[model samples]
Target: MGALLVVILALVVGGCVCVVWADRGGPRWTRVVAAATVGSGRVLRRYQKSQRREVGGGADGDGD
Candidate 1:
């Protein structure tokens, strides 16, 4: 399980690198990776927001 977690972390980091490269016009293939990166990021953000709501957390801008 530890090894698998490490591998997944590595892949996520690599994908983020590809996303940055593609944003800077690295190559055509990088564009595909970048798209996947953006899509996954959006999904992750939404999931996190939903989880926060379930835990009764307000939007991140409600500091007093």
Candidate 2:
């Protein structure tokens, strides 16, 4: 009975963890605001890469 209880507890905890994790994809405007903000370096890099592909030069090539 105790072993069963332990298993149930573990399963409950695991489910809670999964729920929390599944809820953590960030806000709807996260990507849009990230491309604007320096908080998301990876998104910024991808945006810059796309911009470079669209244009002829790297993002840094333009004068700041």
Candidate 3:
């Protein structure tokens, strides 16, 4: 499990690098990878924001 997490982390970092490289007009494959990386990041951000709303959306009035 630990090894799997490490590998995933490495891939995310590499994808980020590819995003930067592709911004300056890199090769076709790097451009493809960068687009994928950006799309994945958007999905991940949406998931995280939804989780936060679920946790903190309580309507109870406690403060005075």
TM-score of each: 0.80, 0.38, 0.80
Tens-digit per-residue lDDT, 1-64, candidate 2: 9999999788556545544444576455544443334434467677887887679654566554
Off by over 4 Å in 3: 58-64
**Global lDDT scores for all candidate models:** 0.89, 0.59, 0.88
- What order do candidates take by lDDT, descending? 1, 3, 2
True-structure lDDT of candidate 3: 0.88
Span of 10 residues, lowest total lDDT, candidate 1: 55-64
Q: Which ten residues in a row have the lowest lDDT in candidate 2?
A: 31-40
Pick the winner on TM-score between candidates 1 and 2: 1
lDDT, candidate 3, 27-62, per-residue tens: 999999999999999999878777766887733353
Ranking by TM-score: 3, 1, 2
Evaluate residue 57 in candidate 2 and report its C-alpha lDDT on the 0 to 100 scale: 51
Clashes of each: 0, 0, 0
Q: List, residue by residue over 1-64, the lDDT tens digit for candidate 1.
A: 9999999999899999999999899999999988998999999988988887778766657452
Measured by TM-score, the strongest candidate is 3
